[model samples]
Target chain A: MRAGTLAPGKRIRPLLLVLAARDMGCNLEQRAVLDLACAVEMVHAASLILDDMPSMDNAQMRRGRPTVHREFGEDVAILAAIALLSRAFEVIAIAPGLAALQKSEAIAELSSAVGLQGLVQGQFQDLHEGAQNRSPDAIALTNELKTSVLFRATLQMAAIAADASPLMRQKLSYFAQELGQAFQLLDDLIDGCKHTGKDVHQDKGKSTLVQMLGVEGAERRLRDHLRSADAHLADACHRGVATRHYMHALFNQQLAMFS
Target chain B: MRAGTLAPGKRIRPLLLVLAARDMGCNLEQRAVLDLACAVEMVHAASLILDDMPSMDNAQMRRGRPTVHREFGEDVAILAAIALLSRAFEVIAIAPGLAALQKSEAIAELSSAVGLQGLVQGQFQDLHEGAQNRSPDAIALTNELKTSVLFRATLQMAAIAADASPLMRQKLSYFAQELGQAFQLLDDLIDGCKHTGKDVHQDKGKSTLVQMLGVEGAERRLRDHLRSADAHLADACHRGVATRHYMHALFNQQLAMFS
Candidate 1:
């Protein structure tokens, strides 16, 4: 019952994708990149479904409700995650506006990020090291998996839809990746200090930045990343309107969260 | 680790890909398809790795060796699997002699198969009804995940590579999907009756054809699938020299396995 119990997430990634496309001058409708955006969000949701399973995090609650596994059992949770991921691709593949080649490109980008190197790798790293003693590097690694790579991919996919210039595309990627790390750092900070609904001090054995460098150091790392992310956004400003507004809004929110 | 373990699998899928290319007069070196072929095999391997995890089959052994998780622990096993998967895409994306768009197509095809609709979906179906009583439909659903979709993807990908006629491609896909199902049926027959290194009857509560139909009925289904796979291959015979040999060889092996 993930469809029912789980409050829907922010849906920010897809919005960024569509907004980026608009910046590039492409007209995105429900049948176009909007469909793809949903697909990407589905992937994100699937990751969370799997992540919160008994075998993984064993998390009891998520988004203020029982996780997919808790609501439907582990098997159904796994199946639901798989269903969402597959449907994500199918929806995008069949979307009206994407040409065969473009469809191919979109699938590749999305899959690569979600696939072994991106999300799965990140998960493995997190679990492997999370079980061990704390270290700054360990926390950095987790951010990459749980956060950065996907952010980079989200922007890249958006750029593909818009056919952004290579230089502009690279710049956007830098922005997204850094921002993602910053976001994850904030998440960890929250998770570590406060119990929320799940386990507290659960990351004790893990190589968290906080455990390694103390709270002060982890905060510094996140702040530095925020500056870097903002710089990339400023660079994207040279591109045009849609890109500028999207970057500005996202960064401002993140910056405000930290402040 | 996989490099040392990477012996020639049946090489059935790769050969099909090459033969399909030949049908379109797309002759390339063994080296050209080597990376792609390896990538394909890696995908297969990654699925196997995930399938045997403690969370899934909980098998202690596979292919006569301690499974990846058993040897390296679950965390590392997962990472190794992810590494194989990501490297597969990297291989396809960077394979020599292909244009950027073509490389992108290869990566996309592989990704689609391994992502939601392909292997992951199959895994979901396998786990969805965990610890529950088996039914005929549940068995069929398991087969859909554990076998058919990837086989369909393999042949479809071959056609894409060679730019095969739509009619020819359709026939080829039919051959591969049916053959794959038959192979899985044979696998169940072998596992249910003789295999000892597995959880065997404990399919985490999901049903198999052998479980639902009994050994005799499952055998009949296997035979039927084999017959269809053979007929499809025969229809695809006029395509090319390589295509004919590849199809014939695959059909013969399937027959030989049961005989």
Candidate 2:
């Protein structure tokens, strides 16, 4: 169960979580913050496990190796994914030194991110992206629901751990949302141009940012998102500028690759 | 998502939760208890969604109709099941009139029941049950983890909601475990003989109590479980007698069918 998550990966979710914790002036190594980071990473891995299943993407490789379902049988992959998901919640619930109210809040935030109106619905939309018209607004909504919300959840869980106010939480959510959109757009560009991953042509029917916005238009949107994320960070956290610097350094690498 | 759960079925788990709540002197109509009942039902439905997938049991029909995967396609079914799961936790986390401690406890209990050493592992064992020796202990452990633990979780969640004592919770766990084993054994017998549900013959390779013990022996063991459950209830609940009566009435109907 832990193999998929503990395997080599970028772990952007966990990193963002720790960054969010830092933004709130909390210790980066706070037990609750650390555990929540692991929780989101595990949840993210579980999602990938499902997304890579034969019935879904049919991808034979991920995280630079055979996907879980490919390495193990489909049965193990499914069970392991579920186990990871449940464990993610357990990690939050049993995190040492966390208050009960905050624990409950974190659970609620995570559940809301993954449940009916969040990842599940987003995945459903993505699956049908080919059948639908996939208008720019639809594509954006799909990206927001499918990707941004989980990112929002990562930061929001951190905010709860730090005892951040509701207003601060809202600003952090906006910051995460922009970051998530930019991340997905960069992914699409990479997949489209480099064909480094799965057969990108197989997903040709699905709408992508590069297809919706011309290459230049998509780059413009990515920059706009970065600026929005910067503004939200400045308003939301005491360490906003520092966080923005870290994010810019990270995004710049992707942007360089995109261009 | 509710559509899947609200579909007609036995709904024994949620029923047991409500009864357990009543046994603890809690109002069955309380919003928290009621929402939790719905939550358990939703989780059960979600499990069915996965269990019926072609990769797993390949069950074409469930709940007297086409299974979710068969009806809505595999991707939708998977997403819908996950949505139900997250929705279940959300229901508990946001449940009104519940204390933070109890809510967190409930989440932990439910997650543990569904996580690494629980349903996931149990399902893995079931897939390999025939490959292993299929000893009585093996079969029993498989049933305990896959089925009984969830039943235990249902009662455990109810105990938390009712503010029941540790001792009371332990007793309820035992009651649920025995009840769960008995329920599965009875189901095996029913499927073995009557063939009312899925193609039981197709599952002949799977270990079952009816196979280990003769039908008569399985029935005997079920009776033993009921007696054990009765003992636990007597020592556990302040209103044990009434709860026992309700269980007896319910069990009798099932026993008559099994016979």
True-structure RMSD for candidate 1: 4.3
Report how far off residue B68 is in candidate 2 (Å): 1.1
Model 2: per-residue Cα lDDT over B1-259, one tens digit each: 6556777787888878888888888887687888788888887888888877887888876766778887888888888888888888888888887898988888898889887667877777878664556779888888888888999989988888888999999999899889878887877777754535444554576767787788899899999998998888888887746667878887898778757
Error of 1 at A186 (Å): 1.1
Docking category of candidate 2: high
Return the clash pairs for model 2, or none. Answer: none
TM-score of each: 0.80, 0.96
Q: What is the TM-score of chain B in candidate 2?
A: 0.94
lDDT of 1 by residue, B1-259 (tens): 3721363346566666666666655656645556666677777887777677776777776765678778876556654665566566656655565555556556556667766656776676566564467677666666765677677666666666666677977887788777777877777766743334444555424557777788788878987987898788778646566665665566566545445
